[model samples]
Target: METFSIHPIGYVRERDGSKVLEVLPEYRPALDKLDEWGHVVSVWWFSGSDNPDTRSILRQTRPHQSSPGEAGTFATRSPRRPNPLGLTVAKIDRVDVEQGLVVIDRHDALPDTPLLDIKPYSPGSDRVEAPILPEWAAHWPKSREESAVFDWAKEDGKA
Candidate 1:
């Protein structure tokens, strides 16, 4: 198998440290004009799951309690998939270009999550007027704003 290398441009600091995307000093210049947009699509790596065993996991039993049962890695957003990569569209609250810090709304990623890339969210292309989802998840919040009060733990079978 061919191997590839990926270097993170920054890290996601949350909770105790600071809920922000701290761009490395060398990558600070890349944050220019990021504040112009209200949101950004962040590509991050699930570093904690970066292991052979986790990557080899191809199926999981009901990642979501609302789900019917077992699902293939691609069927569910399980961190134990072949690639422990995370993609989220985060709401940009503030951007400090000088300090290379970007404050975003709640994200599933943990503190120190390796940031792969950041792209400005364009509603014209990113938003789908009619998206098809499984029956279990069809009742999810229609927009990110509506998700603020959602009980996520309940959906994950944690509550």
Candidate 2:
């Protein structure tokens, strides 16, 4: 069978080195041509968190508690789904080759989240006309602190 390898463009500078992850050095140069895309899709690995040890976790999580029926992993945005990959449609806040950084809209990921790869977020292709998201996810309660977490991650590196 043909083989494949996953590479990263750069580490996420979110937590000021507290939660850092290095991208494959070989793919570091690929970022040179990425600046043209204003926003890129960040497909990173959740190196810290994995599928929960419990089998019941596979059942519908929050939706079941609220909706009264267990949902499948694929239907909900549960983290314990198959492959355990985290897909965030993040914006290209900044890119610095010298320091090896790809600053993004930092809220979706945790500090030290492993940098797997980055793809351009193309409005013409990436967007869906009518997204049928689950009922539980239709409304996310955003607070001042929750919304500002990414801002801190994107803060100036020099300052």
Q: Which 10 residues in a row give candidate 1 its minimum summed lDDT?
A: 150-159
Task: Please provide TM-scores, in order, for all candidate models, with all chains considered together.
Answer: 0.91, 0.67
lDDT for model 2, on a 0 to 1 scale? 0.58
Query: Best-fitting candidate, measured by TM-score?
Result: 1
Give candidate 2's error at residue 94 in angstroms: 1.5
| Over 4 Å off, model 1 | 15-18, 157-159
TM-score of 1: 0.91
Q: Give stretches of model 2 more than 4 Å off.
A: 1-10, 15-24, 51-57, 64-68, 134-159
Provide the lowest-lDDT 10-residue window in model 2: 150-159
Local accuracy of candidate 1 as per-residue lDDT tens digits, 95-121: 988888899886779888999898999
User: Which candidate achieves the best lDDT against the true structure?
Assistant: 1
> What lDDT does model 1 reach?
0.87
